[model samples]
Target chain A: MTCTGLSAFPLTPIREDSVDERAFAAQVTRVAAAGVDSIAALGSTGVYPYLSRAERARVARVAVEHAGDVPVIVGVGALRTSHVLGHVDDATDAGASAVLLPAMSYHPLTDDDVVGLVETVAAHSPLPVIVYDNPGTTHVTFTPELYARVARVPGVASIKIPGVPTEPAAAREHVARIRGAVGESVTIGVSGDPFATAGLAAGCDAWYSVIAGTLPEVALRLARPALAGNAAEAEAENVRLAPLWRLFTEMGGSIRVIATIAELLGIAEQPCLPLPIRGLDGEQRRRVAAVLEALQIS
Target chain B: MTCTGLSAFPLTPIREDSVDERAFAAQVTRVAAAGVDSIAALGSTGVYPYLSRAERARVARVAVEHAGDVPVIVGVGALRTSHVLGHVDDATDAGASAVLLPAMSYHPLTDDDVVGLVETVAAHSPLPVIVYDNPGTTHVTFTPELYARVARVPGVASIKIPGVPTEPAAAREHVARIRGAVGESVTIGVSGDPFATAGLAAGCDAWYSVIAGTLPEVALRLARPALAGNAAEAEAENVRLAPLWRLFTEMGGSIRVIATIAELLGIAEQPCLPLPIRGLDGEQRRRVAAVLEALQIS
Candidate 1:
């Protein structure tokens, strides 16, 4: 499979308590129309863990329907191996091109455990599987050795690492190490700020943009310069987007960022997060609004 | 509520991917018959998070039934709040006197978030809730200030702080601080090896013990001296149990220690831990077995 240069991470918005299917579909349509390369459904930005089994399946179906021709990679993270495999079945049935699997939710996992997880999921998924290593959220990092082991698993085709600004250098090093270790066997993607130009330059094949859920144009514009090998232009766009990145990161990572942006974009009827995640306080909300206004997204 | 003396915690055994309910019941009966103070169901030693909703409920029911008059506190921890609340409901229905809640599960929580969680659960729970602060497993510590805030919640009646052997003096200081902050509103329980005696002397209301699970006779003997205000004898018992404690702590934390001991004592048919918790390896198993034999538990 040819590597996609960009993937829109469509955030799963919650209305009341259940999945907001209408809002999700609308977001998918907007992403596809904005010329995103592909779309990922039910990621951390989408509050994947909070969704019930049926909701996950329905969201995958809705996202695929809206994507039309663009590939939709559905996230398949559940505490149980059976649940994860079941999610893969649902995603594949919903016509998803691949599934993103995070290892053993809510537990500090070992390297062997991750290898076992990738092997188990790979055995079940009909399509290629993507190993998502979001240590900031999952608290389990996939070391380079573990990444190589996971890459060697049959049907495992990609790895996604979080690209926070605090660790841009580390992210670049990791991408380079993973690419060297796994060769062309699997694609390496970075998910975080739009400033993943450095990571993309260091060997990251794709950028997974949370902002793409709302402002696909900005995401596409930011990546265009980077993809075209214009580092100077990409850096300029990065500086322009820095305020938005800081706002989102300060609002407590991707879930809140996606929800807040979706609400601002006027597509989501409500910004509801599952228990344990509260909406941004008054000051934070105002700051986020100011940033969005400056970006002309609102 | 009158403060009970040092409570003995027994390990619940796992066999064939399920709680060895029969063995667990027998163990409970033996511990209670040995004149132990109380039985804690689903502590870290119980492999709490690994059990399914139905299995955890069953364990609580069986433990309460076999425990006779001893108060049983069940562990209620899940990635989702709904599941944790469900476990609370099941435990209360199964005659549990209180529930032990871990603050960290799906996401890393802040102090305010934990305070909110305790209040929310306390409002819903039928039984009094004990805030379990196991930083080793959860990677989040509930500071004394946070505990003080949570203590104001109506149904939060106790705090369980794990003790560290190397820093018994520091544990003692913490116990004093917590007791002073919360006053008589919340009972303080220490859950470590060396700190149990010091914690009690330092004003902790009760002591939570893991050695109590596998060797109730030895655990009771150790605590009997402590509870009777005989420090010298208690310290001697602590020395006797030290080797076993070292073995348990070496295999892993509370869960592995409890499971290993249960197997050695013939109370658990198999050392079955759910996915991601691989039991002791052959070398470690041999070492654990030898330690149990030396301690006369086998």
Candidate 2:
């Protein structure tokens, strides 16, 4: 089935040095309760690449078990196709309903490289694959032509477009272009929580989100208007979510912001970021608090 | 010990799905025989990230064993600092003289982040560290100020600058700036095979080379005059090496070109490039052969 509506990529909570399974499961259950369509474990927000294979597998297993009726979408992005195939197997073995595969590389990927990667990965994967396009993280951006090529791969169910450029014109144009290229055969979802409303207003089918993982109710409040074709209403809510979005932009990634949000919401502990990287400082945390307070999220 | 002179990053040969140890050892032995100053196993040319931890450890072990008196610099770059620390231990256990680290990230790193990462990794590492700057792959560039900061980190012994802009003027200025900033405590070397002569003439201490690994005689033919301060002679040789350099430029990376070079020299079989990535096609292979023929390297 095509992935649709809001899907939560819940933060993989770290208690001490381990994946806090109880906290992780609870986060999934909480988002699932808020009526998100799917729970994506080990997504960018989940820090999949930073975690060891065993840790990732456990995260997926717990995610699937706790998701209940909500489908579980595991991020299976890796540098090598063999490694990605291994992750695909892990997702299937963990009982995930779908897998999100980003074209991850430390090198520049040619068009044929990306197409070959997705097709080979989809061929081996039992679960439907959602091609994730987040050039900010992977340095591999997919044009509409590239998306169309990936969409035609067997077992590919959807594509998640990243929120980039920030300018409403570029964001809107990008979504429209992908929709036109892929047509109705592939589901179109928007990632980068800040641009969800703009993507939805531009006719995206789903929101692959970060905020929804913690503040699902608030995320739903923002998404519902856009999903229902009320562009004016969605844009208004996006204005309210502006402070939080600014924090994401400032941090250069969602990991620290989401972790701080969870800590504020009392859903998780201070994130145990993979070593050499620390969580947000007091100033950043204070800003996060102010944003949450401004939005009245608590 | 500072990394200096013509250090070779020999391609890790793949036989079936595994690192071909015998062929890998032979490659190292051959380069060392040609009198390269060091041997860097698992550098970009080695595809360290594409291999599993076990495979990397195996490659490191084999590289150290075959390197003889030549210093073996193992690439220990990883996404997480914790993973990097693990690799440090692996490098130490393998008996490598030093470890080469690129500021590997899926996200763009800030100045503080880069400094923090290198300091932490160096603190935990048993072997001395060489900071690798390859923006084409990592998307992280180190300014002279940043290199100075990294150089002060206790265990960091050197920095490897890449041949970017390809223009000799900017390349020379970049090397000079780093040298001015860091002083003599940290050795500065250059990578990108074609830029070795320019780098050496620009006052870099070494050429951390790709071509040196497979075509050591030719690589030395270029490096000797440059090392001896014969700029005119080195530039002439660089011009002679221009045809091969163009192939490297066309491919956007050195992996395929080096792999093709090894195959042409009968050092190894067609690389089994981690699946979904095919070797050079007939046209590319024909071009590689023509370049090698013109160079008149038996």
Candidate 3:
């Protein structure tokens, strides 16, 4: 079970301060029912680090139970190796199929720091590790050289490259470079949903996506053609995904935007973000509603 | 009882995976015995976030026990409000007089977010809260308006403005602006050691210092003249401190440099930073040693 095709990182729904377990299970069932290839709980969209260890364990367990046949990927990334190792135990106990590792750092990590961190986790992890390179939040960029090094770690089953090249032409080249660097032994998944069309066109093995986590059909509409090598059709679907993508870009990030979408669609309650952080404003919600209608999401 | 004069943010001594309690207590005692104003344990220099809650509690306990006659300021900043509240309990239980709050954010905080966060934390804090504005690490810059707003939160006793203007003339103006904004009720402390001369000259009530945590005399040497309105003497001391300041700037930030200084002086063991992070390279260490010798710190 490699991380290939559409992996839905279902958002963890919150009803007061606690994880809305039934809502979370329902959302996982919804996304899994949408025919996604895999269900990735506790990725960025899932607010992994924000949840406590017990909360995380419960969320993972609920997600796995509801996911049925779909593979459950848990994010075990954290500041301390010990804590991350603790998370790994939680993921294992929860019966997760895989774990995502992002090198979360307050200080910039040296090459040795990053490489050693992955190697240590990978060596001890109960499940195959998917190297999550989301530098936007972590502030630790896994350069191609770093990715190549991380790919060699024994338990690293795949590499998720969430970054996209700004230039249209550079997209293919970027994917090619990483693909070429890591060889076929590692599966490459492109995240940051906006890049899915070009990213798949460039030969990445999967779309480890945010939009798919909330609106699976829309993500699948875009992914199918792109995965099938239909660039023109994929580009059209990408254009359709634009309105939703813009909402994601404009309204802070995917977490808030997805929360709005989920709420609008009555899929889940307000996202249970860690405090001082909340969901979209009324005006933002209005905009999302308009986009949902425009895109005919239902 | 206020965070006036020089408040030393002592580095946490980590040997293997655990805190070296004896070394940490001695380091706190050494800084306190230097006649500094206060001792701040578990600060950025203290690697506050890197340690677990239990470890943070222990560090705070030991530091408070050893810091005879001096105030102990514990860093209670965390990703979640509940976690910060938990740290507050730790600090209060350990007998800390004040707690420093840095709005640690993975997501860039909006103005409303920052204001809301501080108000929430301040209202619940067991100890007086010091608003820590370290944008370099937290990525959440408290604009003077934000600072003014945060300072107004109940229980917010002081604002530590670590940022200093690049131009010498602007230093006094900048501090004066924040001083005027927060009103006389609040004490303003300047950090970022290089800015000591200018920040102190700018009329900030205290120097929330990193270097002082390790090399107390050197920090006090600069602080004394600046506190006494001896501009020429302060500038001279700033000149003397230039070599050490260069090391802080060149080698990323204070954590690694302070770790090196503490190890060189045998004040603590080699800082066991969370994995993937190690102490400075051989050349960096050699340069630090040379600076310590040149400054005649012993």
How high is each candidate's TM-score?
A: 0.91, 0.96, 0.97
Model 2: DockQ score: 0.60
Clashing pairs in 1: B10-B213, B11-B213
Shift in Å, residue B74, candidate 3: 1.2
- Which of candidates 2 and 3 is the stronger one according to TM-score? 3
Least accurate 10 contiguous residues by lDDT in model 1 chain B: B1-10
Residues B1-298, candidate 3: write the lDDT tens digits. Answer: 6768999999888888788888888889999999999899888878887788899999999999999999999998888777888999899999999999988887666778778878888888778889888877787777788878887888898888875885677997888889878988889999999987888887888999998998899898999999998978999989888998899889988888888888888888765455557889899999999998998876
List where candidate 1 sits over 4 angstroms from the true fold. Answer: A1-3, A105-107, A164-173, A269-271, B1-20, B164-169
Mind giving the per-residue lDDT tens digits that candidate 2 earns over B200-282? 87788989999888889998988888888998998899999999989998987788888888887789888635555567888
Displacement of residue B107 (Cα, Å) in model 1 is 3.2
lDDT of 1 by residue, A1-298 (tens): 3445888887787776677888889889989998888899988877787667888999999999999788899999876566687899999999999898887445345576677777888997898888888876677777677777888899988888777343557756666777887779688887876547777766678887777767899888888987777867887888888888777556556566667667766878644666655666668667778888897776
Q: Which lDDT tens digits does candidate 2 get at residues A90-191? A: 989999999999888876788788999998899899889999998888888788899989998888999998874456787778777888888797899998
Give Cα distance to truth, residue B70, candidate 1, Å: 1.7
Predicted structure with the largest DockQ when compared to the true one: 3
Per-candidate count of clashing residue pairs (backbone under 3 Å): 2, 0, 1
